[model samples]
Target: MRAYLALLEELERRRRGNSLAVYKPYDRQAEFHAAGATNRERLFMAGNQLGKTRAGGAEWAMHLTGRYPDWWVGKVFDQPVRLWAAGVTGEGTRDNPQRVLVGPPQQQGEWGTGMIPADAIADTVMGRGAPGALDSVVVRWGGGGDVQAGESVLSFKSYEKGREKWQGETLHGVWFDEEPPLDIYSEGLTRTNATDGITIVTFTPLLGMSDVVLRFLSAEAIQGLGSSPPQGGVAA
Candidate 1:
């Protein structure tokens, strides 16, 4: 327990090194607190600029690397962890975990408060550019030892094109950055194969009724609701 707490503090310190400021102090604190909890699912519902994505990114990094504190509730995949980091479109992925997953030390402003551990990335990982077809790019990460970029087993795909590939491969985890089609999430979760793999969904709510949103709110899933709809008007 003591070691886990120490590791958690170290992660917090590294997270704070980012250039962006926390938009909501209370919310930021809440996320940090929740980040340490052992719960498999966490929801951060708040207005924009409240650091929800950043919180998710930080936790995702921990999951990717299997460095989560021992006391944390989140599941840690067996290394080499196969991961799927997606967005509504391929373009949106460039700024989020696409970079952070294999980013440099001086975390860019574009990554916002989310920064990857510079030492953890491999040259081969970055060199593996997005395959012309979204399904072509495979990505993976290592923990407890060094992982070469060429060795990244994880793949990057969009909601539209990778269904076949997603269905074929076994994965360690999935991180959906923005709301993805409900069917994609459903199919993707199955790919993780429960060999004790995990799936994480992070995004600001949009159009209120997306299938992914409904699944996140489902009683059987790792539920969360975060948004800043106009006062008196319900979110779509």
Candidate 2:
């Protein structure tokens, strides 16, 4: 059928690295639903093991690398862009979304084969394995100073800090992982108004009545929610 043929073509395009990772219908819908509106805030709610973290990680990776593919606007980041990639805490960044960003070994089915490899990324964002490369691929930035890597330097922070040190700074992008508190998200967003970049918060909605839950459930926000069989044989 024509639909299946189109799907195959798109898959081939992705294989050739000509497109961003393909989202499921619901995920794709959520992206469009959030992008179309002008709301300063948007949220995606779903059960665990869903692609919420994937969506955010993918977008953040692309934007930081200045590699905005189709269906994404406002992602052309300025060089050495100030970025803060955070989770529940520093260790959490070493987990979910950050793990994806850094290219840990494939986890069977959770990420499928679509996840980007750490090596495949340009030297600007990740790093090239030179003769004297560091032990790990981790790059550091921040604390009233900055790192001048070819790619944007993203400092990892914890949601527990609230608005304390996160305020009174300018940023080009901010990514919050796994249900960061609403106040932290708000404060992070304040730092991300450089030119016209974006602030991304990605998480599966666990608690039913949180402010984030309300934000996405509100009539105007994109609504993507449901349950699916676990991927990678893991509950996520």
Candidate 3:
């Protein structure tokens, strides 16, 4: 009885640890993160339920909070950042990136049970149309000498809103939850151009030979970025 009770306590603590504290990605995921050190844009193409989306969410959390695990060998930001996380539609955005980053959109009580640590979430702006969708989340960034220096903002968007919505702000990073339209992909790249920020696209190559797909798999891209894995992997 005593040992069982202690086990339950350990589980509860891990439940709140969140993001990098608990994200132990497989070999493919780690290679993807490591590639971020030199590459500004990367693509992780994989099959469904292979932990690709979770890895993306975990990396973003580390960037927002500037809290990298000891094993982390990826890009690190020294200050608070403004980033965008998007999908093909509002609902898709909510279900994938939003769900992994902030928890279940449909469950209000479980909002903090995601890659972002519960205590690190400072505030959240609810989305306008979709039920329980989030517009943005303010994360408590800790890179500054003081914890109160400033907070990072993670805005949610959908490609369905078009390239116009993607214009304006200079972002620190952008996470494309899935493969996006070539035009939408271009706009996302533009948003991060000024800041020299990173772009992460995690998706399955359903649209075979598409422009976005070609961009990552082309020989030119292979030479520019590092090598991809044998199985489903990353093209930096």
Answer with 2 or 3, whichever has the higher lDDT. Answer: 3
Give one clash count per candidate, in the order shown: 14, 1, 0
Candidate 2 per-residue lDDT, tens place, 36-136, comes to 23544455445666666776666655555554456555334445455677778555665665556544323422221223433234332322222221112
How far off is residue 24 in model 2, in Å? 7.8
What are the candidates' C-alpha RMSDs? Answer: 9.3, 10.6, 3.8
Name the top lDDT candidate: 3
Residue 184 miss distance in model 1 (angstroms): 0.8
lDDT of 3 by residue, 1-236 (tens): 99999999978966865645878989999999999999999999999999889999999999988888999988988889999999999999999999999998999778878898887899999999789999999999884456555699999999999898888899999999888999988988998988889999999767655677777776765455454432456887
Q: By lDDT, highest first, what's the ranking? A: 3, 2, 1
Q: Pairs clashing in candidate 3? A: none
CA shift of 219, model 2, Å: 6.3
lDDT, candidates in the order shown:
0.51, 0.52, 0.87
TM-score-better candidate, 1 vs 3 = 3
For candidate 3, what is the total of clashing residue pairs? 0
The residue pairs that clash in candidate 2, if any, are 110-232
For model 2, the superposed segments whose C-alpha errors exceed 4 Å read 1-39, 71-80, 105-150, 216-236
